[model samples]
Every structure is written in C-alpha cells, then in structure tokens.
Target: MIEELAHDPQSGAPLSSVKNYPGPEVGEGLADVQTQAYRTGVRTPEQHPLVEWSGTREGTLTNGELVSAQRGLLGYFRRTHRNVRDDPDPSMDSTAALALKRLKAEAPRALDSFVWYALAERLAAKGYWAAWMLDHVIARCPHPTQRVDGEVVGRCGSRLKFRPGVGKLEGVCAKCPHEHGAVDEALVEYIGDIYRASFDEEMEARLL
Candidate 1:
C-alpha cells in the first residue's frame, strides 16, 4: 500500500509529492510504520503545508476562534511529525494506530475520520501509553472537546469555534448563550466542512 501511494502518477510519487525527501527510514526500528503514519495525513506538503489559518488575528469580537484553534491543532500535527521524524519510534506508530482503531470502533457513526485521526496523532505524540489513556478519556467525554475559541470576527459578530458538540460535552460553552458565536449559520457550517476535510487529511497522513 505504501509503495503504491509512493508513486502515484498524478501526485508524482509520495517522495516527490512531499518533496522527494524519501520520508523517514522505517525498518526493524519501526521507521516504515512512522513514515506511513505521517503520509496518511498529507499526500504532499505543498497542498497541506502543515498549518493554515482560516481567520485573521486582526478581527474584532471573538470570530471563528474555533477555526483558528483548529488551525493551531493542524500545526500541532506538523510539530508532531517533525518530532517523530527526529526521534522515530515504532511504539508511536502502534499508539496512533490504536487511537484510530479505537475511535473508529467507538465512533461508528462519525461522519468523518479527520477528528479521530487528529485525536490519535495528538495522543501518540505524547507517548503511546499517554495516548491510550487519553483515548479512554476522550471516549468517556460525549463531545470530546473542552471548548471553542473564535478565529475570526469580521463585521459579523464573533466567529466562535469549538469542536462539534463541545458545548454538550462539558458545561463550559453551554454556560454562555453565545457558545456557537455570532457569525452567520452558513459560515459556521462552512467552517465545519473545512475542519471535516482537515480531519480526513490528518488521518490519512498518520494512519498506519
């Protein structure tokens, strides 16, 4: 599977797609597993580039803070990638795999895999045991998110952002009347779509 993805004609091979870097060395030391995991998120660094902000910092009101927060999460993924590459480990791969698998099993009806993958990658970066334990905590939390922050505000109220069902998970966001922010419903939904896509990309890049 890795080899086939490595040489996709449209993408010009995974190595070239990601700048012909040949990815991390995977072997008895679990180099291959780690390589596969990172590639699972971004087919090419050019398309994803590790991090991007959906909203600007110059906004007023708490606009799309969730979107910005989500972008920060994306950066976290890139950071994790670099960290894992520098200090490659097989257990990390195993831990990420477990995170995804467990999420899949628990979130059987999840509309997307991006969030699940992100959860796994985030946990694995810390350590497999840590990730595994975090996985259990996430599973227990119905919403799985603690809070949402605005990423953009523009002229349209505060563009608040948070994980879907974030307000439901804890009494945090729900305590306030403006949990979803003051942005247009359409715009909020659109941002949700983007996160959904990001989640997919993240999972694809790290899945082992």
Candidate 2:
C-alpha cells in the first residue's frame, strides 16, 4: 500500500491519501515520499526509505515514524512509556502498528526479519556501529562447535553484534569469535526475489 498526502486547501496540513500499489518499486515510492516528505523525509538515492511509515487503523493518524528512527520515540521507549498517558506528540506511531498488517499480506510470519527494538539500547547509544541489522529478533550465531584441543563443544549459538553504520553490514559472533563479513552484501543478492530494502535516511541522520 502507498499513501500520498495532499495538502488541505483550508488548513494546509498534509493529508494522507492511500492507494493500492504493488511491490516496492523505486520510482513509485520516491514519488509518494515526495508528497508526504513531512512525515519522515528519508531521501537517499542509494536506498528506499523504510523509516517513513503509515498504516490504516481506527483513530490512527496518517503520519507515523519507526522507533528505530524517531528521536522522540527512542526517548519515550527509553523510559518504556511509563507514567505516560499517550505517546509523545508528533511521534504518533500508527506506521509501526501496521507492521503486522503488511507482513500478513506478504508472508504471515514465514520470514525472519530484523527487530529494530531489539537494539533499542544500542541504537539509542549512538555508537559507531549501529543500524546494521537484518537477522531475527534474537539474532545468534549458528556456527558449528569447534574444539581447540578439547576446549569447547556443541553449537556456537552466541549473540552476534552487528556494525552496519561502518559503511558495511558486518556481524561478529560473541562466543565463537567468528566474523561474518558483509552480511548486507549477502542479503543484497536476494533483493528482487526474496527481499526488498525499505530504507529511510532520516533514521540514519538522527544518529549522526
């Protein structure tokens, strides 16, 4: 689904207009984002904007932002929304709420995807290595166990630390100390068939 926002003649506030659209085509998406750039302006020619999100839900506003990208949401989630009646103003997240809606239409839990929240702490920390995530929520190493003269046994299922902000996506297994080089490149091979990259430059900019 693609949403095009039209400015109101009376109020001049951008209105979210949804229209039926097919797969993630670069040109079509760029046009739509150009209209609703106020929601989340992720204009990077190298990638599609994933941070600009919106969904259809009752009482749901049209402009929504991803927690991974939204600075206010990152702070809100840092507090875990405690003692708060409503989400921060201008940070309304109807966009993320409809994540499952889009997924069900496509695969229905059949795919393993990156959980941006899983790295909330890391992302909020604004470290040198951030935003490079693609594995499942609980991403871990699946390398076979290796023995250095009978020192280790079983699968090396340790958490992998990702550094995608360093101009490339790299994962380092904690337990095995194994390095998974260029996981981003590995995923890029399946872009048209098994994967589509929805990128938002706004998220990256916030970190900077």
Candidate 3:
C-alpha cells in the first residue's frame, strides 16, 4: 500500500488522492523485515498498509528520503505478505527470529537518530501505519550496548556505574528520558522501510 499526499482542491490540506492506485514498490530488505514481523505476531493484517494506506495505524511520521524509501518497503512487504500467507515455506531459516531474541534481551537505549525520527514522523503524516508499527518494535526492544567494564548493559547512562560482572544498570529512569514503552509490533515494518532506502540508494548511485 503506497500513499501519496497532495494538496486537496477543496480543503487545501493533504487529502487521500491516490487511494485507488497501488502506490510504489517497497524492495526486498523491507520485505524481509515484514516477514520477520509477521512470524513474530507483531504486525497484523489491519496494521499492514497492503489494502490502503489510510486505514492503517499511525506512529511517527517520516518524509523525504525515509518516506520515499518507506514506500519501497511497503511494496516489498506487500509481495512477501502474499507469498508467506498464501504458502508457508517449511525450510525457511528464521534469522529474524534470532535477531528478535537478541533485541528482546539487549533492549535498545536510544531511539533512532534525529533524522530517522523525522522520517518516521513524515511517514505518519502520510498515513503509513507500518512506519509506526516498525518504529515501535525497534524502540521497545532491548538495545545492544557495551559497558566500560566489559559487561553488556541494557540501559546505559551517566548515573549508572557498571562493573565488569557485579554492578548492573543503577541509572535513574527519569534522568535518561527515552524509556517509552514496548513497540515490538512495528519492528518488521520499520526495518523494511530502512532496508529499501538503503538498497535503492545503492542502486541509484551505481547507475549514476
């Protein structure tokens, strides 16, 4: 599901103009992300932007590069949705499954970069539910990071003093603000959008 927003003739606000058309192609990386999300039960048919973009859920909005790339991601996932849902591949190697396990265990400490957030917001503005869902998953998962003492920490901050194996995260929850809630549901959608943009950029650069 690809949604393009243009100025409405009557209202002058961005209205659903291209609701009928099938938007654009989301790419393979995004497709993989969508598949992973589906297997994990994070994404739902309702949340997916396959049928129409307007009906999907809302999360952060991302525009420009991220937005364009997200469209490619949507297209790719749409194809995968059809393939996996229609025919289950028994021999499939679930790499995303392992990645999810790590993500759940590690827990990310930070949100995406400022630029990434901006892109996500733009996608939301355009009514891309997958954007919100994907971002949520990554945001909720335990972010991976290392400590000065050589041990791995889920939440790292200035207040916490991590020792090699003894001291864990003793940081103030309020001091380091990014502790939003779990959004594991959107992991696949978000990754799909990111991967599509990367692949497309590489392809375009090579052609240039």
Best by TM-score: 2
Please state the error at residue 48 of candidate 3 in Å: 18
Which stretches of model 3 miss by more than 4 angstroms? 1-129, 132-200
Task: State every prediction's TM-score relative to the real structure.
Answer: 0.25, 0.26, 0.18
| Candidate 1 residue 135 C-alpha distance from true site, Å | 18
Tell me the deviation in Å of residue 133 in model 2: 11
Point out the higher-scoring one by lDDT: 2 or 3: 2
Model 2, range 1-208, lDDT digits (tens) per residue? 0123122211212334443222344235455644444344321111112222233222223233211223222222223222243443222233333332333233322222222332322333433222323211344443435667773333343556776557765766655443543333432332222212232337757988
* Residue-level lDDT tens digits of model 3 in 104-152: 2332322222123333443443344324233321122322345657744
- Give RMSD to native, each candidate: 18.5, 18.4, 19.1
Predicted model with the maximum lDDT: 1
In the predicted model 2, the residue pairs found to clash are 48-199, 49-199, 50-199, 50-200
Clashes of 1: 26
Q: Which one wins by lDDT: 1 or 2?
A: 1
Error of 2 at 109 (Å): 3.6
Which stretch of 10 consecutive residues in model 2 shows the poorest summed lDDT?
42-51
List the lowest-lDDT window of 10 residues for candidate 3.
2-11
Compose the digit string of candidate 1's lDDT tens values, residues 9-123: 1111122333323344422354564555544432332223334423232121111111122233334334345544666555654455444444434433332223433455546
lDDT of each: 0.34, 0.33, 0.31
